[model samples]
Target: MLADFDDACGKIGLQLNLTKTMFMRNGWVPDAPFSLNGTNISECSSHVYVGREVNMMNDLAPELGRRKRAAWGAYKSIEDVVKKTKNIRLRAHLFNTMVLPALTYASETWTLRKQDENAVIVIERSIERVMLGMTRLTQVRAGIRSSTLRQQSKIRDAAVYAKSSKIRWAGHVMRLNDHRWTRAVSDWTPRNVKRTTGRPSIRWSDFFTKSFKERCDALRVSRTDRTHWTTLARERDKWKNCWRPLGLPDDQRESRSRSRSSWALVPPRKQEAGVNLSFGVQSSNKRSFLHFLSNIKTVSVESIFETAFTV
Candidate 1:
């Protein structure tokens, strides 16, 4: 394969940079050595291509964090202008134009799981909080309502934005000719490859299949009719509004709140594991400590010590 590549490149008057060349394994396969011009090629788990990270596991957390930081830098540059502007609509427009692209750059290629979706949402909400010039604690203390803030900001959900982008990219890819490399790969299925024992890792095509089935049930009809697919994919407001029904449920929100609050409490010490710290004790002082701990719902010994020391 290397000899063929060398010949092809030589015919084209192009030379392959052996030092920059590296191989990445896609599945659970043992690493093997490859040599080019007597130079050994290094194996890598992931590689950066066209500013996007490609990896075997397809984890987007690091990429998301990088995008978030870049977006935050963009936000900070115009933050003063945002704060001085009384027009909430203009502030939102600036944010959408300036910061959102950074956050969503190359997002069309991402195969997002629930955790990745949540991470993006958290970043969006945090930025919105900053735009509103209020911290979470201050917002709670001042009796400032969430609905009011959201109405004023007019910031759409990041997840909805990402989903729309991905769907649009898919539509674009679908329109490409079968002769194209991307189109060919998108449609190809490997044959004669030995199967691993466990469940196979989800591929991009698999993710797209599930997403398209759920979101665009009329995909087959749309494929037959280009105009219909274009209308569905190109209409931004319609697709954005489609995500309303997919919002997190009230019970899930409550559970998330409980989980977050749980972080405030310290865990029990190893030495105190066998000790009974229940409220049935006769001493009034210990009863108060137990009651406080129960009410707070935190189980950490560090928090207990901090609370006791503060008191």
Candidate 2:
């Protein structure tokens, strides 16, 4: 593919910038250097692309550190304004628009772990405390709650904002076109990968799954929907069919059709291309896909009444 790309670029009167081009090898790359048109391309341990840092190690600490540095820098720059300002609204605006944005840059893309969330929460609270003239000693001495500090400052918690952003991004990804690379990459599992003996990496999609129980456990609290969480966990094993990938098929008809992906924003109501569409939606000349942001809908009072009467 590299050779073909080189050839195609040459035909189009363009040449590769050997010095500028660099490749990141994930793990155990070969001794032979990868090249384009006999010119060896540089390999890098890390590179900042369009602001975000990409590391060969896949460790998120560096990116989080970068965000921290940026946030602190932004905060320090406006510290005088925060300290001296009589206008509470102005201080809040600056914090939200400038300082918070720096802190949570591209946070929607972050596959955050519990530690990462805690880190963000701490940073935000620390900054808020500084603005409110509350030192660590004072915060502890007064026995002030985080909720009280947020109420005093009139600023939302940064960690909560980040989680909200991430969940919203997840929904957007769910509604993405099947052909979109974002959707494809979300579902793609690496083939022939060796399993290390430890806890599996957290998946972004786990927000929609039974893993919410684990999250609540980590938070050391239970939501109002505790029973609902338990139900999902119990039903996972109960409801699943014997559709193991390694097992022999019951019959050809029983096998899931692969002509279309099982995921969709809206399930098809009619047949298409001689196959059951299932949850797959095809191309349409109707309303704009972007016009409607998410498929999640709330039942109105009228709808509840209508359904109740119909029932």
Candidate 3:
């Protein structure tokens, strides 16, 4: 196991030259390729190896604290190393092609689950409708007061043709304001309607509310002063321009490019175990390498938790 240490050190740019420093000369060469003699080796019993490893672990405790404080700086250092060591274009392709597809697959699985839940809700709604068919229905009608009935009729008429563009209910109501029938006519004009050359319409309910009248008095700005859809459209265009540097293509280009590529989306392949790919066998080991590290971590954490919360 010790014979491989020098190669590992070389891989991480920690190679030591014996003549360069006194530490190396004092038989503490940190990057010696191998130890043939007992010069850098301990000839003690089994306890010596455990003691040295414990000391190494103790040294790592301060390193762990330092790493926690400077995590972002460490991340930038790692990114720099990766950029220096790998092909940038290949990395981009792997991220966009492979990693993106895996992420999309996971997302689509969640979406599919949501769709299934919605389908179940629809089924439940249909069952409820079927259950409602078992109940008996009875119709009822009564005579309405003259003035209230007239107002209700006008409201019903306005609601019936609400979507009609040709019907100018606002103009009709304004012309009939001098007539007695105008008292029964509800404010048929839209509440938030904009008029080019006329006074803006007010809510009929607001006439009965003191607080709403006070609020209207305070708000002196006209409807034209408020931001509208045109403002939002300009902001949307600004955002679209901001994303232009990501090399996204127009819809036409995207369609044409996708047609040329033979990419496909399929359900992820999940094997129980021992499924051999061209790369390697899928060993059915219950524990991962991370599990071993986690076990060691849990022991340290348990010690801390025990000390802190002892009854």
At residue 85, give the lDDT of candidate 3. Answer: 44
Identify the runs in model 2 with alpha carbons over 4 angstroms from their true place: 6-15, 28-31, 211-311
Q: Model 3 residue 91 lDDT?
A: 33
Candidate 3: pairs in clash: none
lDDT of 2 by residue, 1-311 (tens): 56666677789899856798766554444456777667887877877654667553445678788998998899999999899997766787788878888998766666677788888878888888988888988988889876667656765557655654554454455555545544545555656556567986655555445444553464565576343322332332211211112111111232322221112111123223233211222322111111111120222323322322222
Question: Which is the winner by lDDT between candidate 1 and candidate 3?
Answer: 1
Tell me the lDDT of model 2 at 300: 30
Candidate 3 residue lDDT tens string, 106-220: 1110111233334322332222222222211211133333223222111111111111110122122223334322222233332443344685323322221332234334455
TM-score of each: 0.63, 0.62, 0.13
Error of 2 at 274 (Å): 45
The per-model lDDT (C-alpha) reads 0.56, 0.55, 0.25
Clashing pairs in 2: none
- For all candidates, the clash counts are 4, 0, 0
On residues 1-311, what C-alpha lDDT tens digit does candidate 1 reach at each position? 66566778799899877788766554444456667777887777766654555554567777887889988998998899999999766787788888888887776667677788888878887898899888989888989876456555775556756655555555555555535433444555556566678986545445445544544443343554333333443344332323222321122123222221100111122122222211111222322232232123112333433343333
| Model 3 misplacement above 4 A | 1-38, 42-60, 75-311
User: Candidate 3, residue 172: CA error in Å?
Assistant: 80
State the lDDT at 184 in candidate 1.
Answer: 44
